[model samples]
Target: MGLLVKGKWYDKWDYNNDEGEFIREESQFRNWITKDGSAGPTGEAGFKAEPGRYHLYVSLACPWASRALIMRSLKGLEDMISISVVNTLMGENGWTFEEEEGVIQDPVIHADYLYQIYTHVEPEYSGRVTVPVLYDLKQNKIVNNESADIMRMLNSAFDEVGANDKDFLPENKMTEIDEINEKVYGTINNGVYKAGFATTQEVYEKEVTTLFDALDDIEERLEHSRYLVGDEITEADWRLFTTLIRFDSAYHGHFKCNIKRIVDYKNLWRYTRELYNEPGVKETVNFDHIKKHYYRSHKQINPNGIVPKGPELDFSLDK
Candidate 1:
């Protein structure tokens, strides 16, 4: 992992805090793209939705980035908003589009590295360069880099341009969806990273325990409810889906989140396959990219960088 220091690249991976907990950096580009070029819930305005006017830079290996890709596919926005997937392995250069299998080189800005795109938006930008970035072609600026916000944008922002009307964030379940998102985001989504990147054993134990506790809670909830919010698949379910899909393959081993594999949870494993089988969902998942990235990228964790090949997954769901 690396970050840009005032438009300059720096190879670094010090994400731990004084307490040895891995703290995720807040996304710097918070601007939004609304349907009518109006200001969104939390950003400047004038980023109106338009076909072939926006692009996405993402990494299939990243759960956060995968959320945006899933939404784009689910909402039928593939042709509306274009995407360029970076290489799976994040090395010293940090999220490059260099020639590699399953990698789609950046065709918009033609940048070799993702940080170059960030610096192009703000020459002196200072922050961690992350994926799922929404860029405006008309305005020639970064609309938003936060996955949650981008998901909402793709849900409704381009409806006039022939995008799907399936509302992932419905009005009635807003409160419940937000509440579930909070818990899942804290525990399951970010929890694995916190555990894997923890500098001390105490922090790792605390995070891993909290992570499994959250998973157990969700497993119990899924036993009764078809989805996280209810019968309808909401933003909450998709948000959790990205992390769950990668749990057994990467987190369980590479992240040392081996308390149990996601397959060990009866309801969750079934639920995962159900979602995976959902139309347009499976296409977004690339296990080769996911495994290679986590295992090979983090040299501090696995210095030898040997990718594992066991723990075969069965993504089949019973009717």
Candidate 2:
């Protein structure tokens, strides 16, 4: 919840606006990597597909960063792209690779904090140091930090260099996927944060209501369809999976998004278990990191910083 100002670090959280609504900042880096060194849908070009040329910085606790990790596993890019995971606790320094369980330290720059990597890319970098950061080691710069863009890039950018040929963004279903992604991103994905971090009661009520409405709509949709888009799992499903997986565990009580838990909706609960049981998808999930980061990092919300140990969720597919 901290940001860098003119290359200096400040421990603060300014995500709320005058209306007390949580506003997520747009990622600063927007470059893309193409299979043939061509420019992607956005940003400049020349980032070609190559093995061992890109590194991913992520935190298992973060849903945004988890998108890239899940895509990496689904697209079979584990060998093509290296990854470094930060410690679950986001202390004053903000996302450190401090030696701890589940922390995978940065091997390229050996930086202490995540912001150091941003400043290393741009000496006077000024922005929120968020992950999943897609760094180009050959250029020694961040190719992208936006999770949505990074996930798309990982979906097919490295196919020439042994990435799986899975087409999460198939052309035939692009329109439907885009439509679904737009609604889900606003109401469900970001809506929970808006409700949880609201400074006023009015903002919280509005956001929380919108969140459940979206969930209800999705529950109805899944009643007949196996996945979000088509018969097989698509990018849309994975995008929503990150938020849904964290909803009952973190968002319900911690974020005050308690209109109803995902498990309460029979269809949604079954859908979540199906996705969680997907190949390599379960491996990307770490409930311990997810619970720790939300409870401990957001001191403004949980002043005591006492991590909860209950709420035993049944992600089991058996019933």
Worst 10 residues of 1 by lDDT: 310-319
- Per-residue C-alpha lDDT of model 2 across residues 1-319, encoded as one tens digit per residue: 6899999999988889999999898998999999898899989998998999999999999999999999999999888899999999997999999987899999877999999999998988888999999999998989999999999988888887898799899999999999999999999999899899999999999999999899999999999998999698999999999999998889997899999988899999998999999889999999999999999999999998887886888888898
Candidate 1 whole-model C-alpha lDDT, 0 to 1:
0.92
Residue 248 Cα positional deviation in candidate 2, in Å, after optimal superposition: 1.3
Worst 10 residues of 2 by lDDT: 305-314
Can you give the TM-score per candidate against the true fold?
A: 0.98, 0.98
**lDDT per prediction?**
0.92, 0.92
Candidate 1 off by > 4 Å? none
lDDT of 2: 0.92
